[model samples]
Target chain A: MIKTFTRNDLIRYIYQETTKEENTEIENALIFDEALCDELGDLQLTVNGLGRIERSPSKGSIDKILSYSKYYNMNAVN
Target chain B: MRKYSVSDSQLISLYKNGNEGAFADLVNRHKNKIFTTVYMIVKDQYLAEDLLQETYIKVVNTIKSGRYNEEGKFLPWVTRIAHNLAIDHFRKAKRYPTIVMEDGSNVFNTLEFSEDSIESQKIKEDTHALLRDLIKELPDSQREVLMMRHYMQMSFQEIAEATDVSINTALGRMRYALINLRKKMDKLNIAYDKNLYQK
Candidate 1:
């Protein structure tokens, strides 16, 4: 019997939180279910869009982190 | 020889053994996501930078003191630290209301768009910026679930435990967050063009 996946199930599938069996089931369902496919597509797009908006810290922030690590190491060694 | 990406565990082990370069690699690998996580909560680049520094300092102290037991889960562990620090700062300063402008639009909406940019790139940036603002407009519970799952890459189970909610509740918030974001995007007439998102 085919499984009826909920939106939460699809969310887990997108995030790769589903088990192997569930993954197989969802992939099969996607083949025959247009609405399911569309829902998954919309969710995936929004997640991907959120990922693309990332901003990096300044170089100075990174430098300070590295320097702090080095300083701690030096203090520990002495 | 083909270049192989080093695992976070390997980098952590190296850093623990006095390899600063490995620590630098780890930071460079995960900095953007970590920074973005804090920036989303704090909403100020400079303050996020400060918190990022503090987060790493805590990370360094934990690792150096031989207390960093989160072996394989480096990114999420670091992200939790950043998230907590940002939340502490947010609580102490009460800065939540400042993100809303007098016109009801978010401060992020005021970011300048370049007139001469390529159309697709412009749209992508505009959409992303607007989406970021929309995220801020979400209910705090929904926003927390979205950030914990989407940005911090925490599992819904982990998010449930962290937020003191049921797993189903976490999943429901994520679902609503996505549905609401889609509805808002459509209302604003933003095209959900997959072609525009291609690298």
Candidate 2:
């Protein structure tokens, strides 16, 4: 019996989150399934679009965590 | 001297044994990822910082209380904690899904700066700002899944566990989020990377 992948399965494949066995199946399907391959490409690009605007917290944010850790250590010691 | 090359599990064990700088090492390693993850959800730098501090404090308490068994999975574990805290803040205040406009302005706010000067930088900033605004426009549930999947970089399984949804549901939300984002971008006539949709 052939296994049919769902929309969810396509998403998992696009995100590279599938198991090895599932990946094999998806790859085999993608080889012959032009629509499926296009879906994967579109989803990948959509995910990529989200990545175009990466933001990081400021240095002061890191300092806040460090200071909190220091305080926790001091309190633990006393 | 601390073995700086050890795994997160080893560092965690060293911290458990009251090593001087082990905890600091761990915090330094994961701080930015944790902070950025929270900031993405909260959408406010100051509030995100506060939540980041709270997240660490909870981590400290959990470690001291002997309940933290997660070793190698430290980053995901703490990230879950941070994500939950952000949600909790929203629930407690009942003010979440609120679009935190930087200038307290309306939505559809556009760039006001000169297009001639620093064109590249301004375009980049505007793109990010507009995208941020679009994300804010998503329905709360869809937005949550999108943020966790993209910002936290969590797996569907991890996202399912964190949000208490099934993996299938998580995947569906992600799929819908992409579909919705595409539809919104089309409706707004916002130019995206067109090459993506062409092929």
Candidate 3:
């Protein structure tokens, strides 16, 4: 009973970028479309999960990159 | 964007006028971004470090020789230089065709944002690792957009400017990336309990 939906529909729903009609359509699909539910669930999880990944670079990497000044630019202050 | 650490525009003006400190400041400000971008493309930390130096030298010389077209705008110009050098590295290693795209499109997986809550953090970190591996298998162009948006904290507008694409294209990439990621995770049967993030 999963109403057939397009990629655009899912995009709108996930971003909450959908209209009320589209939102209702997607929410309704949740009742019948097990696969869609799983996919939507996974999409939410992935977006949320991605929010937890470590975005910062390794410590000292910035210092190491600046180390280049030592070789080329004689006047560069470290 | 308000001269937090001497912005790219300010540094470019200083450097153009022959101020030595400007060069160092510019280097300090962007080293991490340059390093990370290079590392992603080269996939080797050591080589990325080297390419970083090479990228700067080229920028310096390009500016010094007066061949640089970007009069005041520096980061975008420098970024392009770094990207070019990375492409050169892959080319010299005979890996160009596999790595460099004519459109200069390089994509990556969603970034793992760092958090402080230890309790939920551990589970989130585990789930992050799962998605990270799956994303690495994606196309470079797709992966790059996802990484920049999620990890680098770039807005869609910034991403489009950085990637030389339209806003629509950037959003399209993000949309497609999410959908593809969901489909891939589904096939892998990875499960993330909802209660984890609710807290």
Least accurate stretch of 10 residues (summed lDDT) in model 2 chain B?
A: B104-113
Per-residue lDDT of candidate 2, residues B1-199 (tens digit)? 1235788888888988887488888887767567767766788767877898889888887887688887337877788899999989999998864556564322212233343356644455565577667777788788888877776667889888878989999999989888888777778776676322221
| Interface Cα root-mean-square deviation for all models | 4.1, 5.6, 6.6
**What tens-digit string does per-residue lDDT give for candidate 3 at B1-199?**
2256556777767877867677778776666556656655675555665677678767766666567776535665566677678888877888643332212111122233344466555555556555655666677778888766654545667778988998677777887788788778778676655423543
Candidate 2 per-residue lDDT over residues A1-78, each given as its tens digit:
346788889888877788999999888888888888887877777777776555455567667666766667566642
What lDDT is reached at residue B193 by model 1?
66
Best-fitting candidate, scored by lDDT? 1
lDDT of 3 at A5: 82
> lDDT at B93 for candidate 1?
81
Question: Which candidate, 1 or 3, has the higher lDDT?
Answer: 1
Candidate 1 lDDT over residue span B84-111, tens digit each: 9998987888766356322322232322
Tens digit of per-residue lDDT, candidate 1, span A37-63: 999999888887777667778788999
Of candidates 2 and 1, the better by TM-score: 1
TM-score on alpha carbons, each prediction? 0.87, 0.77, 0.53
- Per-model DockQ: 0.53, 0.43, 0.17
| Candidate numbers, best DockQ first, in rank order | 1, 2, 3
